[model samples]
Target: MGSCEVYPQTIQHSPNGRFVVVCGDGEYIIYTAMALRNKSYGSAQEFVWAHDSSQYAIREGNSVVKIFKNFKEKKTFKPGFGADCIFGGFLLGVRSNSGLAFYGWETSDLIRRVEILPKHIFWSDSGELVCIATEESFFVLRFLMERVTTAQESREMLTEDGIEDAFEVLGEVQEVVKTGLWVGDCFIYTSSVNRLNYYVGGEIITIAHLDRTMYLLGYIPKDDRLYLGDKELNIISYSLLLSVLEYETAVMRKDFNTADRVLPTIPLEQRTRPLSVMLFKNNCLISVLLNYLTRLSILLQFSGEQIV
Candidate 1:
């Protein structure tokens, strides 16, 4: 299928590569890759595909971001101003003029907000890291999920005061960086002149300079590869050094669920790192303790007994 529009502003393949999304002429089109059959979804200023490609979201106008599941409109909410919104795993990132806000895609719950407008934003495939670039610096934010016992508690947690208890800034680079992607603990990005650079362990390393300007399109954590698009419309993939940093970071933050999801992606040898092993054991112990405490508290409450 084809559109009568002169050209499409952007074209993207779903994570599973089963479908293609084309945006142009104020419409977003979805096409099946095999037969090339297509459908238009009307007007959208911007759109983003979920990491698994099971759903997608579109920035409608300036204030609202609408999510679609199974190609149907699922939910809509105001994520402040600006049309920059992205999704990875269960988290959604939106850029407002005031700051960058992260939300739980399923619940529409605000997770955290950073008081800065980033030039570029990228969420790690596992949703453990959020890497952002600004004119003067680069930053990474990390978060953990906690079990909330009540709807009231969850509501309180979404408030600005409680957001600090859920997320933290992992690191920042005091240098001007362009498009970037997070790979484990390292951040790979390009400079204004299209110079490839990597930041790890507080050090920035320049890798190479490309002949033409390029933008980071996406990253495949499973394959440890980055997809880049250049001005000439050429797309290229480059292999990157894989690390278990995402898993370790998640475990360190006590986000076992996310860590568990990332664990299988890591090489077995890397999984045995001392910190990883220790954190795993500690997390298990904490889980058991919390469970016991919860049960004891409930029993006491039901028995109407007072503790000394």
Candidate 2:
């Protein structure tokens, strides 16, 4: 195996397991774990792997973060006063000294900023919720990207002519619980010092209290279980059916936006099943039909259509 002499303080493997990042020696090094191909960046403080692991950003300074694609630097930006870490998705999550902020990954536009400094930050696999943990509390920030009217459309009355241009909107946040990892729709965490706690549909439940502290490693959607590590270095697994049920209920309630954000996290086999595929397709069709119906109704009313 090919290895570097430097010890890494922060390391992350890409979601696809094709690449790995090592942060140390005042540089960020990226290399394929199974091969010898690698690249490095100097004067970097922190870095984040995109969900697909194909892109990344390195913190060059307190305010500046440089993004890279395919091992090449693409763009740089000064996010704000205290931006430290970067999390990639439809938008970029920049962690600063004051709080977290969102920015357009491509346009380099500032979207929204939240003022909450956290000790630990974990973005769900689906990128739907950002789980932040502090010594005294925990927070879950939910985000959605929707199309909206552009500024140009608002100003050009003559050009508008009943047609409006649209742009992506970074959504708002909702605090679900004091602490925990958001697995699917459920929040899982260690509470009361040593007990495993989870919340589903606004209800809090304690699964067990351990003699020692346990850390949540990650979630496995295929088995609907959580992989955890204990202080003594023991690994444990726990089921979260309630959380899965919560997600399904959201879909049944026609909360397709949330459902769409979470759909990527489901197992591929399940997502490809005939019934699952049909359900998702139907959801999309319903949204399109409803939108056209709304436009048709408005047009008919303005055209003076008569009721029979």
Candidate 3:
């Protein structure tokens, strides 16, 4: 509804939606998104927001990196040698020669290092897990943020190696993840094959194969739906559930104990799709037939016709 003093080349809103930034002509302004007041300003070649959106980084003067907390400059330093890219979040991430290395925002000390080729990094809303999308695949990791942050704040003793203990790479999925979002322990992504899938505990299960490129925008737990935007900018949504995701993951892993336990706990109406997904997985002919029968029974139950 208004114009800016400087025409913006790019505009980005924080993940938290509290702040908005506009960059143009090597200068930037951070504004309170609602009231549109300029709270922070600086000159930098690049501007990147952190995971929580409370902090951000700006690259200026060659290798120099600056971090701003709550719209105020907090720290400035140089990324270590072999580091090529900067990603600010729960930690200051730099792509190094071997892998990704994280540093504390205040002390700039090494928090942990991960060995992987990362093209994009997505941290979960809860900040407990992170998904690193590589050239051809994607992987997840458990970041011990509390532990690492405590070590930084208390200056506690670390092992001689000092890292290795702070993070664990869960595993990688070779699916070409185009774009995705994380909800709790599940990662919902659209693949290169035009399929929507969710990953959990190293296994992936298909949700649908709509032949359109979709980007995950948000998930509403109360309504049990995911809002997505397609290439044409049309908004679409689909029903999803966390319990169903967990049950399907357990089933894909062939953990019958877990699958059987979680199956009945799912809302009755949502049970069919989870089982239908398994029918096409790597299961054999006999398993497929059995799953087929199970689907029929679920349908009958849905129609209020009990299976005799």
Candidate 4:
């Protein structure tokens, strides 16, 4: 807010990098980042930015989260009880001491209610999936948004009782996730044990091992590379093809039709990349996965180049 004298509890930058929000002391002020000029100010306890950055939300003293679209108040409603943290975006999400609840942005209907307290939540790039990270494990769920009208709200199909069937559990891992995000249908993460792995179709595979702890910055789809940074100010990258993972997932799901369509799309050199060590050691899943991969004539050996 133009370098105001008041100290803020936290500063939030919009996803599009156009606006900045300063929040503290039960209020927030918006500013145009480039001009360093104040745009608007409002009362709030907590603030969140929507996915597209076209709208924003704030938790008010009314115990409700308010959505502001184009600087005009559009929606406001209280989430499930005990929800203390706002994680709003394309969907309205709030986290409490015991669980997390989500609501539809347009109808304010309960979309999901889960009993797991998460340390981090990741929405897929296209908003088709979401990954919830807990202290002991992480799980992925597909996000479903169905358009409904008030006339259909009371129907048995569109009850406010929450859409449990829509948010399907894609996969889950017992390992603690340090950092990660989604790339296509696969979720790649750095585990607490310093192992980089990808989870798809209920299978977990270790693709690389980190000699030292590092953080995953992001993946560059154009370059087909994954970038990681360390506390020592060093940046490293690795070749991670998006199409290859997609093909693997399709095969795991037994969707040969999708696999056939995706296989030819991968580049020639990237097509033969080595398969990683799958997590079959933990349980009886090894024999099944091993026999499955063996059927793939393309995968004979496994070895990947490590970047230091």
What lDDT does candidate 1 reach at residue 261?
Answer: 59
Model 1, position 62: C-alpha lDDT score: 75
Residue pairs with clashing backbones, model 2: 82-96, 138-178
Q: Give a tens-digit lDDT track for model 2, residues 1-308.
A: 87765688988777788877888876777777788477555568788866666677788767788877777888988875567666655456787777766665555556566565665665665665566665566665555433222432344421212112222222222332333566665567776467777644334456676777677787776677777786689999876543344545455446766655554344433433332433454464455235434544675677574322
What TM-score would each prediction reach against the true structure? 0.66, 0.65, 0.76, 0.74
- Clash totals for all candidate models: 0, 2, 0, 0
Residue 99 C-alpha lDDT in model 2: 74
In candidate 4, stretches whose alpha carbon ends up further than 4 angstroms from where it belongs are 1-13, 20-37, 146-154, 157-161, 231-233, 253-258, 264-308
Which pairs of residues clash in candidate 4, taking residues 3 or more apart in a chain or in different chains?
none
Using lDDT as the measure, the top candidate is: 4
Model with the higher lDDT, candidate 1 or 3: 3
Give the best candidate by TM-score. 3
lDDT of 2: 0.60
Q: Each candidate: what lDDT?
A: 0.66, 0.60, 0.73, 0.74
lDDT of 4 by residue, 163-204 (tens): 556577877789899988788778889999999988876777
Could you give candidate 3's per-residue lDDT for residues 1-308 as a string of tens digits? 34565668778899889888887787888888988887788897667788778789887754777888877888888865455666755667777566877777667777776666677777777777888888899888888866775765666646433465577789888888887888767888888888888887665768788767888788898888888887788998888876777666665556666665665557666756555655455462244336435855786668675432
Models sorted by TM-score, best on top: 3, 4, 1, 2
Order of the predicted models by lDDT, top scorer first: 4, 3, 1, 2
